[model samples]
Target: MFGGVSGKGRTGPVLAVLAAAGGLVVFGPAGGSADAAAPCAGRPVKAVGFGAGELRLYKGNGYACAVTAAKNPGTRRRMSVTIQARGSAPAGDSGAYTQLAGPVTVHAGSRCVRATGAIAGGGSAQTGWVC
Candidate 1:
């Protein structure tokens, strides 16, 4: 399982195929300042969600990152991003993607990546799922 979205049961390759079919490209570094944007820096892929907020995905340098933006729903919410090599679980001896608090960026050096916005009140939404 990829952590948050359990029903998809989809693999990394499938997600990557979907992303590519959607016109998204693999990202890489562009020489400049460290602050300079990567190839996929500003572009974000939208994910499935509950329609309460906005979720975006960014991929670069073999890592995938996510950002979530929501209106005032009066609840504490945070975004999570995770990634793993193709056909690998989020947890195992293979080492899973490092989880990070978002809209901050994270290094998901895996073949596939997933993101979700979790509310402190026990509600959550999938932000992005891609390879």
Candidate 2:
């Protein structure tokens, strides 16, 4: 399983994490510098960059997860992340955040998956389709 979030941030930033046992772990705007790491299990398979951040995808054990991490994290800003398995509705998270957006996930048992993310309303999309 993947460990704690890791991205740009201040030293000794606050953190909150849950066990990545096929579940979602969300951290709110924490104190001091707004930087944290990406939280998810599995090996990274694909990533798409944006103006201010990036969308990363991971896969393992027939499951996949996605994350949107900001390149610069300090001020409160808009962020969003989405992941969708083919034939299923997409899952996403968006709001004013200091650091990152989501670790949106899906069960991709032999199916293709698409992920999208944005920081400050600017971002990119990916059709990994890593079947």
Instruction: Return the TM-score for candidate 2, rounded to 2 decimals.
Output: 0.67
Question: Which candidate number maximizes TM-score?
Answer: 2
Q: What TM-score, computed on C-alpha atoms, does each candidate reach?
A: 0.40, 0.67
Backbone clash pairs for candidate 1 read: none
lDDT of 2 by residue, 35-104 (tens): 3444767778887887888788888788889988888888788888888888988899988988878888
Candidate 1 C-alpha lDDT tens digits along 1-131: 43344455556766776677655334544456535632236445555444445445677676555644443444444434333334545411111112223544555665666655543333456643576
lDDT of 1 at 70: 46
Candidate 1 lDDT (Cα, 0 to 1): 0.48
RMSD of each: 21.5, 14.0
